[model samples]
Target: MKERRHFIRIVYQAPAQLSQSGAQWSATLKDISLHGILLSCPDGWQPGDDPEFQVDIVLPETDVHLTMTAELVAYDPQSLRMKIVNIDIDSISHLRRLIELNIGDDALLHRELEHLADLAEDE
Candidate 1:
């Protein structure tokens, strides 16, 4: 398939937690973008006919965290692709700053933010 991704993905590894239906698992944060996240699937993950999940990613040694409600868009034996559906204000701010620091291009980051805003407006 043609690459249809509009957001720039940042490869950032961190510790994360995923929970649903009272089951929680520890996962490794693989990569992140404004629209989604990719995580190394936790062991014993039994998707169990449900694709919705809540995630909490903590920056290794700091208080910063990114939390969101996500839908399991796809998954493989090694990883899970989740589309972020909702995020709190604080998490979004932290996420934007993290992306800004890693993205390294001011104009490109601005354009991506604008694109994200346009998407939000359409929703």
Candidate 2:
């Protein structure tokens, strides 16, 4: 099996109501991909349990806010890190532009653009 690559960074506040037990916490995203994100939170969370939460990502070097629904896919108690999955495309697009701009690299952006172009060509 081949390993997959991710193309985004997580940077935002943790969702308001994530648990029924009133365990509210905040986290900062370390990296993000279209599929999921790696976040570091103050409290420890468990994997396999779905946590209903929202994430706010400010576009790098800008104030554009991108918010979306995220589910906890995996967790590490020692590291206090978790993997959030099921990010939407709209949020991905917005963050992609910001990453391209702030990072000053168009590789990923170009790849996405080309993918869109290919889809358009097919249509």
For all candidates in order, the CA lDDT equals: 0.94, 0.53
Clash pairs detected, candidate 2: 8-32
Q: How many backbone clashes does candidate 2 have?
A: 1
Superposed by TM-score, candidate 2 places the C-alpha of residue 72 at a distance from the truth, in angstroms, of: 2.1
TM-score of each: 0.96, 0.54
**Candidate 1, pairs of clashing residues:** none
Task: Report how far residue 65 has shifted in candidate 1, in Å.
Answer: 1.4
What is the TM-score (0 to 1) of candidate 2? 0.54
- List residue ranges in candidate 2 displaced over 4 A: 6-23, 44-48, 58-62, 78-93, 113-123
Model 1: per-residue lDDT, tens digit, 1-123? 999999999999999999999999999999999999999989999776788899999998899989999999998889999999999999999999999999889899999999999999999
**For residues 1-123, could you state the per-residue lDDT of candidate 2 as single tens digits?**
875444344344332223324455555556654445566754655443446556665544665556666766556753233344444677667766655665666786677556645755775
